[model samples]
Target chain A: MSEGERFTLAEARDLAVKALVTAGTAEGNALSVATALVAAEADGQKGHGLSRLASYAGQVRTGKVKGAAEPQIERLSASAIRVDAGAGFAFPALDCARDALVSMARSQMIAVAAVYNSHHFGQGGYHVERLAEQGLVGLMLGNSPQAIAPWGGTQGLFGTNPIAMAAPRREAPPLVIDLSLAKVARGKVMAAAKTGQEIPEGWALDAEGRPTRDPEAALAGTMIPMGEAKGAALAMLVEILSATLVGANHGFEASSFFTAEGPPPGVGQLLLAFDPTPLSGGGFADRLEILVNALQSQPGARLPGTRRLTAREVAERDGLLVPAAIVAEIKALLR
Target chain B: MSEGERFTLAEARDLAVKALVTAGTAEGNALSVATALVAAEADGQKGHGLSRLASYAGQVRTGKVKGAAEPQIERLSASAIRVDAGAGFAFPALDCARDALVSMARSQMIAVAAVYNSHHFGQGGYHVERLAEQGLVGLMLGNSPQAIAPWGGTQGLFGTNPIAMAAPRREAPPLVIDLSLAKVARGKVMAAAKTGQEIPEGWALDAEGRPTRDPEAALAGTMIPMGEAKGAALAMLVEILSATLVGANHGFEASSFFTAEGPPPGVGQLLLAFDPTPLSGGGFADRLEILVNALQSQPGARLPGTRRLTAREVAERDGLLVPAAIVAEIKALLR
Candidate 1:
């Protein structure tokens, strides 16, 4: 691969699957993970895309993540399901949850799935988009290892918890919104550090709890929560829902997703599906259109998830331009 | 009453109830509304407190809000309930929902209540706190009359929707969070206008869609959504869930809550309760404590709702120092 290699969506997915399988993942599990990663790339979520493959493979090779572990599902209630990922990659667990939740939600009108003992679930929006495509409203919350501190606290105590929500549309792509509680993703600071660039003020703090623009110090310290105290509170809400309510590891107890560390992250995710037909008694689509029309009618107004949907369309049509270095690194896993 | 007048909690509540009753409200209905309004004052939410009594009484007098309407509850499903507020105040409706939701959540693991044909439900946190006190995780979303424009659009298409969430704790007060999707509440601009003070830039835009610092101009324009586009998206989500799903008036259709000239505001509220004991199989309290300990261990970190709880305690003990003008106005209603 040269400096500017590009691959069709299917080509990139196949390569990812092969690399994961060669690095000791079960073929089926590898395919699921690969499909998600490739979708992320296609949707222009570069950080969550093939760039994550090397680290994932390393974790698998190091036995920090069980490459062939099977998720165990339990029916906690008629409308609630729980899945234990057996310290495996999160994609398979999420897939299992989605299947159960969709069926239950259709019948019960609403259903929830709690997933534990899982690894990183990339691109929360992707999971919800699938449910939205099925005409169900989807919600997802995931807890990661600690990155942001509690409000007014200097010590990191919670993850950069992320929440994603999607609602089905009558004609347009589903409305999707995915946001991290932090002002910005921590990966941006790492990228800045690598490029020897300074971060903006208020993006992060130093070890001494003072704001800093130096990316290195920011990386060593804490990311600033979005909306100040309010964001931290929202992060805590996600932590409690995704971890505490699911009996999974607390953010502080979880290992780093970026490293083949001392143990599997044992993080958790919660997914919910709601049948809008039963809840709204039909006309959900029309009501959604009313809001949508008002939104797009104005200049500069754009719905969330539109960018990713557009990116996906382009990638599906013309393919994705992944970096050459990332392609080589993923291929090296096979060698 | 002079410039500074203090009233005991009972005194304040009694005054509110008497005023409403004098304005033609049923005694029981007046009590419920008074209790809620007095609680708001005690909790330091002046916008929703006794200061709102004048407008409420005027609405009752003008028959904009039915003074003696009885809310009718319908069990939509085993885990879902709906309440028609009978074009009356929202307190009675929320009371009905809370009563039904607690028992249903316990039996069903999770339950939801949607209230329609309602007027303003003040201080959403107050409602969720009730559920949290009952050892349930409470989530509430309410749709108000239009005050916020769609993202990138100057037309006010959605309300400054509010969301409230609360999780129970073992020993500490419940962890509660309530936030409006707007950068600032619309009341602040109104208050500023009354004081002839300029608002901060970025708080709102003028009618022409240009940023403005004049409070009067800000009131005439649309609020800047919190977190830019994300907040508008959230507001839309709330609108769909609370109004569209509940078969209530859309934000665009709802009448003004601050006036007595129109029909009932016909707003809506949706509340969900999750019994953590059943969902988590006990140990819910202990797990919550771990995160609470971590947060409080650091100096300066304080949980949401603590300040309000403390304010309530002080108000109960030392009484509330409300404006003499406001107190006189309430008395005038009785006269």
Candidate 2:
């Protein structure tokens, strides 16, 4: 293992697909998961990238994830669809939803898809951006294992629910926004803990309901909700939409996502698509351009997805610097 | 005029209706607008309450808000409805949307109503809460005249652009959430300026785009977005969803809501409703109860709508402390 080893996007995806297939995932599912992971790495979301392969492989091997399960899609209503992930990867279920949504929204003006019995969907922006790229407005909400408490509550009763929204643009890339309800992601705290660094105040509370800078204590306790009570309420909104409405396991009922848990963390997601043409009666592109140009005109003000797009370009040109040890660890999965 | 004057809910509504009728609003429209305003006061949202009656009256008098015009409803799709407000107050249009949303959502599982040519729709929570009370999840988004700039731009190109969501609860009132994308409302800055108080930093910027604590400067300049760029992007999302998608005037094209001069604001709104019975099995109430109890079990943890609900109760029992001067102003309109 060397310190300076780098892998091209293709090389990383190939290695990941090999590891997943070796761990018993079907070829199609493995390819989907690998594409998502490699894209995350290329976009600078390293925590959601290759670093997750080990846990995923372990889950597949332990049968915590049903490697060969096929997603089942049901038409709930004229404009609503439901996909049960069969206790497997979420990408295939999401793909099914997307395929249905794009066509249904064009005809219906708006359509909704609910996904259940799924694993982590990884960086929601990826899925939503796909719809936006096709000229549809996309919104996604996901519920995970509990990491945040309700406003004024000491116990972690809700997940740091994430929401992603994207709207198509004419000239520029789609306007994409992805954020979790927590003030910061738990991954950052975990990373700090690994490096023996103290977290900043206000990021989290200890198990005793007291604010603490210790990353370990923060992880054990609850992450602070973004914008305080407002953020917590928004998280609750997501929980109800993605879990209760979709008939998926509640955050409290789901297992930890970072491990091959006792059972598949039967989480849920909701994706909504809207056709701007029929809904707006045209001129969407011009209006969008006006707003986007106004935003970029400012010196310091940048759109949410700009950084990721820049990183992706860099990765495409020069490849990604993968720690040789992590590469070797992933490669060992095929052994 | 006295300092300690109070008005019952009935009294406030009667006065508002009288004023609107005196200003040439149709009887039914006046009643609708009165109900919304009085309810805002009862819920302690003074900014959106009876204090708005004067501007509403002025706009009607100037014909900027068509006092006698009726909202026209059109079905765009099976689950989508469009309401043209006829340059009138938004309450009537929203009521039309609500009536349609409830019926359409029951049959279709989900429904959306887009409203155009509308004036101010005060306190979006009031609208969504109505749907939640009927066992339906409700979401509302509205666009206003420009008050905040795009993320990095100095010129205000978007409104505070509020969003509201509410989900039904089994044993308690609905869990309601409403927020504006601005760090602080323009009304707050206006009030601060009147009181000669300096606002907290980060709430707004000066005319030249420099941070300023002086409320007057903040009002003359632009509001800071909540959560920085994330908030601005959300505002844009609302602008596109409510205005562009509805075939209404964009935020930059709309007139000030507070003024009677200039053309009708022609702002827009979008309301979405989902029926829990069809979307989720019959267990929605039970699941909602579980989450609500878990949140309430902890000390000091309160849901978003709790405070407003409490205020409504107090107002119902003891009436609202209406400033004698404000009461005089409304009564004068009746003359």
Candidate 3:
């Protein structure tokens, strides 16, 4: 925002696609990955948006992430699936997993799939929203690299460990809930470091287990577990699902891919989709519709995913906002 | 604990099981259901323990809940499933679901099972702990009858929804978290009312949305959500997965079995279990063991489920302290 203006959604995706393709991606993979990133920005999640292109490009330049590899799925059961991202980024892996889940859930009533060795998947809400659109309730849980410290400790031991859930409502936008177990996402710190700003206390601790506001100290030290032990416990839940259960890296084993990398981060995500219609006896859709109506009727109620839905609507109606700096960075990478 | 002293785990189970059987249950169902309740008390979750015997008895007496019904698998897929509890209580239904899921997970690696048209299942931790005992990572979610309002709403539209997760840990008891998504659970209200104590101001709103100190008045109104909207949103997530996704009652339709009766509450739960060895490889278990070591090393760090584990250890070591009156009340029900 400080070093750029805006571009419409089309222009942003177009530039991204072109840059990714120029970096040696297949046309289809490039387009989808690009669209996914731009969609993140349009949906108000600037953290996962075009800002990531530079890192992606850097990884591509170093052979850390392959752009052209297609994800492969080895189905474990009609309800369980595992996708190896072919050493590629997360978009392809997620797309494969999402498609497989939607199909499996129609008859299975539910499906669980894990994607491993994929790059950071942008805003998990997008995939769950897509699943909701397919008439399936979707829940996603993922583990990233180690981030915050355990409660009463001063060293990092877990990732932000995010969870996102989405359900379709009849004649209404999908209901979505996406959250980070960490009080503040590590991205906020990275953003602060980028902008040279200070953070509030209680969000993180210094190396000596003391609360601090200095972003630099916060980064060099450790983040406080959110909500004290509760957040810490939830993070452990995420680790079990996303790391230990999914056979991916756990805790400190998964390294950060931002500045450096050791083991491809081994991020693992669990995605679940269940057909709502069958579960509802033909009333599930109507019930959610009613639930949404009631939520909307509340004086200040905003149904989950409303803002993102509206944000997407506006982006479609007008144009997507692509910061000029991001565009410039993408352009430079392409050149 | 004023009117009654704690009973030995075995004695409590025996008394509760005898009462339930007298109400109509035949062997296996009675034992499984009784075990769940006794386990709750053993875990120190008195709210879900023998305290519900009276309601369970009333439900049986009125023919609202089946005491001698078998759970049927309504739908089954390799990694997905649905079970109909035959309009029975949830304890047996969940027991069956976990049994099925364990088999599915062994072959599928990950499996999800939902139970429909069932009464309260006592404590979710019991089932998840069982699954974890099988060396699988287990996550459980359950929704009860409506007792909570949406974040900013003044009316009850959600159950005191609970989400629980359990995982195998190294050198420590299984990590388990089971909590309702309300500032205070309904059990707390019941406890306060029984003790003739005033409820907290934000715990719930009295009839007509007035924050009241009277426990009875607050019970008549809606329970305030935990952390406001976050709690409400989380409750919504639980509803979608446990109810909507399971084809059972959601929200207000959930108002039966617990307080009123239109039909049995049809409580539903979604259980996810996966093998950690395959996902985390050889060192995964040891890595978590290290985490357990670190958690214990933290000053004042009592593991999340440690309280229950500690209580059980002490109770086992010192024997349960049962109040004479509680023993008499339980004996009366048994007779």
Candidate 4:
């Protein structure tokens, strides 16, 4: 949907829930995933919002994402937990892990949880924010199917690894940064596909090493590393933490959540929670607030999540902007 | 020294140690710091090598970096420890932390350490390699003086915030990725300045938010975030873990390891080590080696630290390169 279209957040959520239900997702699962997507769209991250529906539906149809699967804790220690996602969509797995992490971190002061054998999880930022909202410092990472080339290689060997973190900032919006290690997220390529536009140079490559602007060609080729080698390096680090360490897929074996091919497409995720009270002597939140204030009040510099929060404030006040074309597409699918 | 000039590795280490000792560092501290710089030069990280001596000397003369201060353990838990760096350069602090962490990780299985009030630690990749060389997976992060902006807005609110990790790969070199969150390391600007070269567009901005190619202007300007916002987010995350979590100076309050102003910089670093033996269930190094070989076998992709290792290898085979100019500079400093 374009920016001009409007929808109440509730309406958008309900519409998405219905769509998920129609696609055979369990009611609770449908509601959960639906809320996640709506939350994304409401905050104007349309790249990950409703646009993910068709791919999610396809995964469900192909049994790549098992909505009814239950994630089971595989290993637990005093301060760490590892989960097997039971070949399910990753959101529920991550949710279970994050919830457990908060409880575990309460006593341990820090908790690290890993989710493996899961399908695609969306918006890592949201998960960190959830922990931050509860007054914990949170960091999240996920490794998808290999989609970015390692430095110097022309083929994809690293996922568009997304890392997110959030720290509470009192009245100010939580200082959250959710980012993919890749130069540009693969979603931008998909966005270009839908818009029939060419991506910028240095963004991607065709099957050969040569750069290509065509989204389709770029996908067939490889996504460029964020800045030559560093993006590749960061992606490798993510793979180790989220996949190799978590005992999930690594390298080319990792399958995309949006694609239904290759062994149910398992992915890996990690969530870390740190109790600020221990570190701050109970003044942790204040220290975080001070840091946030420093950034916000600096001569120049925006808080990481400020724009989203600002957009959210406006959306709450004036209703959300939805693309009419996207709404029409959704309506047609529902009918 | 330019690319083809060579010197034996011993000769390089000897010279560096001599120079550091001449600059007033204690013998042990001088040896360690000199070894690190030689290692960086061997690894082909010219920007981080002997090039840093002038600034290091300046900091020492100003008393920002103590010559002989030793780090002491201030707090210890079964799985964690906090060290006070005693106003010394990071080499001493990190050397102590590494030994302590290795000992702890051997028993605890996982150990985390925070070094507070430390100076600029050298190339992060080397630290991880040290841990990896000891057969452990290592993750290290250090937040320097504020040099990076958050995302939008402007002004420096974060440092070049470097994050690095290393994984043992059996007989293969450990897979390592060490990098700064800023699009370009501040050192690159210094290099450009020395050479009178223009930084590429988009790498930095002038003091007023206008983009600039001049190295001097970019130095005065806030370093641009690495990948638009992702870079900023990573830097902020690093600050929290490496500074706030460790109870050290953060953001603007952080003292410049490269300059003389401000109270002794309370630089902090975080180090976490994981036992791959437990994760791999034995023979993990061989499995890791297999993974490394697979990646290396792929055309074009080089392991992150290979170039440095190669440089060191070549330097050892021949001699370490000492530019006539750099030697002249060092000799001049002795008087």
Candidate 5:
């Protein structure tokens, strides 16, 4: 167990797909979910990667997530589309939205997609990158289960909602920026709680709204929003855009993302795509490169998502090192 | 002069328009500019209010802002419009874009407007609120002259870029959220510098990247971003959306917004409008009220923009208090 196992990207994807299929997910749905998880893993986001399979499988088993459900797409208007994820994995719904957006944005110059009743959307950057690769600028926001309190209150009322943006580069991979509203991801606290560890101060508050370093207390309490009140405000903005505007469950009304209990998460996501060519009159690429050069010329300054790109390159060239225990667990699903 | 002055909203607008017109701004453009400034003052945003009229008039007089330029609008696609601000005041350009967007969004369900070659756009919230008043969800981003540095960089290469969002409520005023990327507005530093006052720590870094309290040194240096690295990243996102995508000057390339020197600033803005009725299938209002109630039910928690609403109500009832010196300054412009 001390020695970890390594798998090529293709092998990892196949292994994940097999495990998901064995857990009763439809083959097409399993493939979509597995691809997203593997991509996240390659980008060094273990919190959203293969680590999520056990809970996901349990949820499917209990019908909290309908493993065979297919997303239904509706053309709401000339430039807007709505997708009902049908209580299934979010990857397929996001894929459906991205596919629709690429063509819609090209035709209309700008387009938007709203997806509801979805599960965990692994690594928001993954969805937006697809749009960038199609020569579009992408912006995405999603609401998860509640883990953050309102700015001055003790009760959790909003998710550590995420926002992501991606733009195509002239001669390189797209520039991707993704961030969670919280000072730190709630997953870090959950991991620390499992390991019986104390979290650093300023990350969370206990149930009485007092700062606490104990992971368990923090888990039962709330994660602190980044930039204090400003971050809390942005979280609420995301909540309204991703959930309320789409008639999906509010953060406080959704089930947990970390457990297989109760109803489906029934969360929602909003994605916007713009065709840079028409928007910029054919100047977007040159202008973007100017800003990129300015950023790179500065000492000690680096573009956002560079680390993720580096991780992806190494994983593609060699293989991803996965913990042996988790690999074994994944294999057990096949048995 | 010893007695402070108070002006009704109409009186304030008239005073501002008179000063601007005396300084050679066209009557139409002056009225638009005065309207925005009055709105800012009513919302308690004094930095963007009448305090800016002297500089605005000076810039107009020097031709740093085109006093007679009419914004030119072109429909780029079914869902996008581009407005050439013609190196004129941003308020007029924003007005034209908003007028076009309300109709476009209603037909397309979502629409975007990109305005370039613009002068200072005061209070990003003001533009978005217009869309919300038209029963559309609105988001706006604008980049100003350079005032912030990239993360870990010593030089200022980005503006105190602002982002604002507004949504209509069921039985209340539209919910508006607006913020600058910097921890504090650069105008506050400018004020402190004029008075020979020191600023608070953590507000800015000296030219050599050392933290400083001296307002003059901070003025020549870069303002610290709101949430450290995350804020810096978001600033870059806004810069690309508002400036680069619209083929306008980058933050570093733009001239000062507060002075009558150099060429026109030629900055840019991006505004997005979504018709909520179709996107939400007629459920947006009820869903938003649910989230709003959840926040208000908490004893200490209040909705965003409540302070601005309170300021507006007071100003509307008792009129805005104008400082004697600023009144004198405006009077001098008339002379």
Candidate 6:
């Protein structure tokens, strides 16, 4: 952050929106995507931040993403909603889903929103945090293009599907826990290979489905799941909830999220919101404080997402630093 | 099946009911508890099956569990139902929840059931399967007495909380996935200790908060969570969902499920049911088939709950074998 060029949060968002709009994205959709990307960047999730703009803009220009597509929201039932992203950026669709779920959950006690034909929903925590901000407990699952294999199988049949959950607090920001099913992101292996380093043995499997430490071999094979087999099972559950239940393309069938050379990924996401007040008999917030106190009081025990919260505070005070090369590339999009 | 005394499934249920009734359980409650235990036995979950009868009967006899308490169900909101277990066995309350959630989910497309003042829920998957049987996707979470410590801490602050999910299929039994957050069950450690064997390194932390393979030391320590920190986080999520949200005792505050001397556990469980038809635009079953076929096609890949299904089939064909000691104990209770 100290070495790279810095931009205020507003400057970052405006820059991204301008670049995306120039590449044919609708203003509202671009703003939604920009906001999510900037939030991710501020939180130190650089992989999901402004680095994604070049590929996203490329997809829009190539018709792999309908930059101006309007997301359509449907109330399928009293406590169910379906948002069709129309092969557009995922943020706007998720925004629509969040808007619908907040009120629906207040009335129904619990509600679900499913979005299909969408692009990547960066920082899964972002969507759930919004729900938590409104005094609701939120859980979200989203399937991406495949990266990890089914446990014991050589083929990558499931996304490093992410699951995010958020619980509202009475006097603090919501507590958000976000994790991907994969042991580590694929980019780490790529970086290791570039530096001629051996990756961790359990990080990935070789082409023949044997454990390997060779980064090159690991890339050719599939990434190992977090917690081994249990993670694979969780990944499959996420796939079933986000993809199968949404009637969208499964992870294995989706196109790449990092490239725009193929068809739209057509991935899916599911968001569930619950009004904790009635469910917990009005004691949810106070009880949560008890658990939080216990967690924080323990020596060496850290609450999840504390690091992200710290990073966000730093970014808010001193602006976010972006690599000059990527900033240059994004600026070129405005031409 | 060949060595131990065998009993037909019906006989198993009847014996369990008689033993619990003799211990002063209400007839209706006894039947509910017996049904779940027998189902667990049939599914090869012995830890939750007949082996639990002695402890359960003891608790009932000692008045730690209210033997004649009836689960009282209240509709908390349009899509929320609360079943106070009345400090009774958990089965009857979960049964009330299942019945309420099935019809509620069918009407609202999604509904939640929260049960507090409950005892051990035997097998978490059993309740979810009941919902699946009624054409609903079911997810259940329950917090138990503490057996695991928070990550990076020495004290046991969370239970080996379990999460179970079941999705209904078209022409097959529901696909059910049930997992406890612990790396391995504490019983494994106890067995190793009895036989003077060493447990695996990551299975537990010694009383001094260091890794240990000696089963004796591990027994006095906390069980490691599955997936390390991620698993601990999930356990916390389950604790929040089941205990905090239900206004029931947290894992650390609850009594041991294995003993009859302490206060009632007063644990809690949460079940969520979703109607998949409308949510998936009536294509839910078909889309699930596609994923199932893909998974089964892989040679080494096994569906999550196939082993349980096979065990149930075998039990249905041939009677289940029960240890003579346990049979004697139950028979003595009845006498």
List lDDT for all candidates, in order. 0.86, 0.86, 0.76, 0.76, 0.91, 0.89
lDDT of 4 by residue, B1-335 (tens): 24434567777677767776777778888888888888888788877787777677667776778877777874445556678888877887788888887876666456677788788887998888899888888999888887877666567777788999988775677778788888777877878999999999988878777788999999888888766666677788899888877777786788667676667877789888777665433445654555566578779878777767777678778776677777766666677
Identify the runs in model 5 with alpha carbons over 4 angstroms from their true place: B1-3
Docking class of 4: acceptable
Interface C-alpha root-mean-square deviation of candidate 1? 1.9
TM-score winner, 4 or 6: 6
Model-by-model DockQ, in order: 0.56, 0.59, 0.48, 0.38, 0.77, 0.70
**Residue runs of model 6 more than 4 Å from their true location after superposition:** B1-3
Tens-digit per-residue lDDT, A261-331, candidate 2: 69999989989888877666576677777767667777776767888999999999999898886787897
lDDT of 6 by residue, B243-274 (tens): 98887889888998889998999999999988
Runs of candidate 4 with Cα error greater than 4 angstroms are A1-28, A260-262, A280-284, A314-335, B1-28, B51-58, B103-109, B152-154, B191-203, B260-262, B277-294, B325-335
RMSD of each: 1.9, 1.9, 3.1, 3.6, 1.2, 1.7
By summed lDDT, the worst window of 10 consecutive residues in model 3 chain A runs over A255-264
Candidate 5 clashing pairs?
Answer: none
lDDT of 1 at A35: 96
lDDT for B224 (candidate 6): 93
- What DockQ number belongs to candidate 1? 0.56
Native-referenced DockQ of model 2: 0.59
True-vs-predicted CA distance for residue A25, candidate 4, Å: 3.9
lDDT of 5 by residue, B48-129 (tens): 9999999999999999999998999989887899999999999999999999999999998899999999978999889999
Off by over 4 Å in 3: A1-4, A22-28, A190-198, A222-227, A260-263, B1-7, B169-173, B194-202, B205-217, B256-263, B278-287, B290-300
lDDT of 3 by residue, B52-76 (tens): 7767866776668888889988555
Judged by TM-score, which candidate is best? 5
